[model samples]
Target: MSTSTSADPRERILILGAAGRDFHDFNVLYRDEPRCEVVAFTATQIPDIDGRTYPPALAGPLYPHGIPIVDESGLESLIARERVDTVVLAYSDLAHTQVMHLASRVVAAGADFVVPGAHRTTLRSRRPVIAVTAVRTGVGKSQTTRHVATLVQSMGLRVVAVRHPMPYGDLAAQACQRFETPEDLVRHDCTIEEREEYEPHIDAGVVVYAGVDYGAILREAEAEADVVLWDGGNNDLPFYVPDLHIVLADPLRPGDEAAYHPGEANVRMADLVIIAKCDSATAEDIAAVEASVQALNPGAEVLRCDSPVTLDDPAAVTGRRVVVVEDGPTLTHGSMSFGAGVVGARDAGASAIVDPTPFAVGALADTYERYPNARGILPAMGYGQGQTRDLEATIRAMVDAGVVDAVVSGTPIDLTRVLTVDVPLVRARYSLREQAPGRLQAALRRALGR
Candidate 1:
């Protein structure tokens, strides 16, 4: 059975994840456990995150030789080569069937497939927590999180947001990070994704913390915050046991509330369910999602909200054929045809949304192949120098092709800061405002005991 005999033969565990939840699983679930040893981390989703080490600084003293981070492609061979006894699937946003496919492979490779429950990895925080999560990746979780932070601030509570970890760099240095200023982002060597999430919070005048060691990050956040905001990632549940749990469901993806992993768990556990994108979706779609939420979780309060896109420069968009660039994750894994960029562009009277497919290059080209949902918009994909360059080149090609007059970026951060597109690039921004306002405000008031 390959059961552990003693200290000499501990269970060699390999964790499968993209980067975020995988590291959190190890930190909270098995970092110092004497019965198991985390042999390696298999990364997917985020690019170039593999071929690195889960550095000894974060790996702890027992594992002086930092655990290796490898691509999930070699899962079977790595399982055999590392003598892995158990494989914990720690990432999020996969279909149940897809999750089971990997589980089948793990079982075939002669290792136990473990999916730790939401409660298993959740840490207890010293302060009160308000967690914002979603039923899917692009269900406007980030916007909802921003709204919660704003409400908390409105109440005059000193709130610090603990974003789900995006520690794609040096784990040791990123063990407990705080991003209060633009310099903090540069200091941490923040990637485009990290900046997209953190910069908005900083702009909102709320401090944000994220990194490898969430326990340490929580403590650091708790020291200053009257309440800690758990800004969740990729349909995963709150990393902390929350005093208030707000879950967002996308009307665009009606049945997904009960379909995906951990996300459905989030749906069941939520104190409040937000049927977001009410403005963009049809009545039937909204009712279907609301019905699903009600059927699955009748006790939870459901609020309807609209995510309206606003263009920074409406004049720049009107009467122009624009190359629209939406957030990368939303377009890729989130499987959306368009985001705020396309919506804002159309609303602003844009002549047409230029097709970036013809100009796609490198990972951007591969991204189109991987997820064909992006029909008229480009994904603002910039995981590294190569991807950023590819995005710039694609946008430039669209301009050079004379199909687009300007660029409209729907990412949270300014694309110009990271990439150089030859044409004028305007940003598309969106925020959550409840259709029935008292529902959200009242819920927050009760949660915070105001």
Candidate 2:
């Protein structure tokens, strides 16, 4: 094996067998590395080889940026002329033999051979960050975050949950302690100590910091946690970049007209598109939604779920709702919602919280317009004097509207009116309720049947 001094910073690294996603990976790895400068790309000839350009220039027209494409025929001459010292072979198993041959030839020309081991180096340096966002609020953005976080945590890995456009609060405080303001969470690497003085909150062996920007929180969590889950988006196109992204669809909301447009951009960036509220959707509606998602994200996986599945046994549901609270606003809200769901189920003799929004009844009725069982309910939104009254009103409206079987909110509202008006209220900060792991896991088990 020919060897060169590892300390040499000027070594010309020639990337071989680059194609498709592998090529993209190579570009990301050395795009800004101080020591590595990718000078050229080379590929081997196969049967009926298309004369298309290699390393397909990222920018410009035709050849683009003047990055020369070399085949096996021009390998030796190009290597010699470029004074290439190191070769980085980025090829799959099928091209391994061809890459080895090229390495041998390069080494014979008085250069060093660097075989990138088969042990997936990309996964190590390239953390797959996924941003969960919604077109608008109250569309289950926070609920989706909790569900995804639970899935990630169940995979035997650590996860950090962050709720953006909000501030971090105390998970232990009974009255919900607001520690740092939203602005403080936006700063890069803002020391944890500067904001709040509290004990650490760990979930499935992973430490979680609630209420931070999706990007900033992910960066911090990526340093320590295996995966990070963002609860909300602060602004449009929250980040210029992301590995994968998801957008939740809420059919019950009337103002969702603006959602589909932003979804166009989000779909372009997403590796998968998930359609929520599937239970209330018709076959034609599901098909339409799928087509919409596919138009933006071609070849992206689309998963649909009507509502989170409830644990079969009451004990499981009770355990998930009544115990094990996670840190963060999203989680806290999720927990409260789940607890309310459990309460609703118990009171109504129902299995789960069905249609937890006042508008859900109208939406469901419209969806099942032809069905005889279809019904509509106009819920009352009560703005009470105290927090408890507000919470009660929200829960009562939801329950009476047939949106929620049980109510969960910070304040209390009169449910007596719900019986007459067909609406029930569940009062709780939804952002905090969705953070609880038990709630998430229960919801996932209910939704995905896993």
- Cα deviation of 184, candidate 2, in Å: 16
lDDT of 2: 0.40
The regions of model 2 sitting more than 4 angstroms off are 1-126, 168-207, 211-219, 233-240, 251-261, 309-450
Model 1 residue 209 CA deviation in Å:
0.5
> Looking at candidate 1, what is the lDDT of residue 434?
92
lDDT (tens digit, per residue) of candidate 1 on 1-450: 123344557878999998899988898888889778888899998889999998888878767788888999999998887788899999889888889999999999999999998889999988889999999888898888889888888888999999998877777888899999989988888888889999999999999999888888888999999999999988987899999999999998989998998788899999999999999999999999999999998999999999999989999889999988888888877878888888899999998888889889898989988888875678878777678889888888878888888899899997777888777889899999899887887898898899
lDDT of each: 0.88, 0.40
TM-score of each model, paired residue for residue: 0.96, 0.38
Off by over 4 Å in 1: 1-7
- The number of clashing residue pairs in each candidate reads 0, 58
lDDT of 2 by residue, 1-450 (tens): 113344556557676652322243354455446565556666541111223333223312322343433564676776777778777654332223444576689888867876443232223213444467654333455446655765776767666654442221221121112223334222322222212111112212334454312223345556766655544441123332334566665443322323433334445655555666555447677667677666656776666655442322343333121211111111121111222233323433434434333333332222224322222211122211232243344344554444343332221122332223232233222222221235434433343334
